[model samples]
Target: MRYTFLLYSDRADSAQMTPEDWAREKEVYGAYIGALQEAGVFIDTDWLHPAETATTITRKHGEMRVQDGPFAETKETLGGFFAIDVPDLDAALAWAEKCPAAKTGRVEIRASAMGDD
Candidate 1:
């Protein structure tokens, strides 16, 4: 089965980290990614740009409306995601727990919808 892991974190708090802290965080992420690759569990992953670069589009009444930034205000914003194929949910959950952001943020794991292939 394939699962999508959505990583979320507080944009404000993440942006407040010092350069060294950021570098260390990146190193941790790199290490985790390397481990995934070595284990052959890595399918795809990517980091999203800050929320400020996001755009929200909606249809109101019959017209399309577009706005800048995220669609809604929240303490935690989606920072990235990982899509991987695993034998079962248990294996997916194990990977989620090992994610670096799992301690300070959240890693939401959802099985990919059926017939996606």
Candidate 2:
């Protein structure tokens, strides 16, 4: 099965990260990604820009509407994601537990609906 791990964290926390903290964070995530790659389960991964950069589009009453920033106002914003192929939910959960965000933020695991993974 293929699962995507959506990482969410408080934007304020990221904003407070010092240069050293950012470097350490990179190293931590690097190790996590390396582990996934070594296990041959890594599919894809990416970090998103701040939520303020997002552009939202919606259609209602046959009219199109555009909005700036994220659709929801929340303390935690989606920061990144990792797509991996694992055997089952248990395997996916294990991987998600190892993610750095799982410690400080949230990791939402969603199985792929395509069923080809």
For 8-104, candidate 1 gives per-residue lDDT tens digits of 9987777779999989999999999998888888999999998778999988778999999999888898999988888999999999999998988
Model 2: per-residue Cα lDDT over 1-117, one tens digit each:
999999999988778889999999999999999999999999999999999899999887689999999999999999999999999999999999999999999999999999564
How many angstroms is residue 105 displaced in model 2 relative to the true structure, after the best TM-score fit? Answer: 0.3
Quote each prediction's TM-score.
0.90, 0.94
Candidate 1 accuracy as TM-score: 0.90
Error of 2 at 27 (Å): 0.9
Alpha carbon lDDT of residue 81, candidate 2? 100
Pairs that clash in candidate 1: none
- Model 2, which residues run further than 4 Å from truth? none
lDDT of 2: 0.96
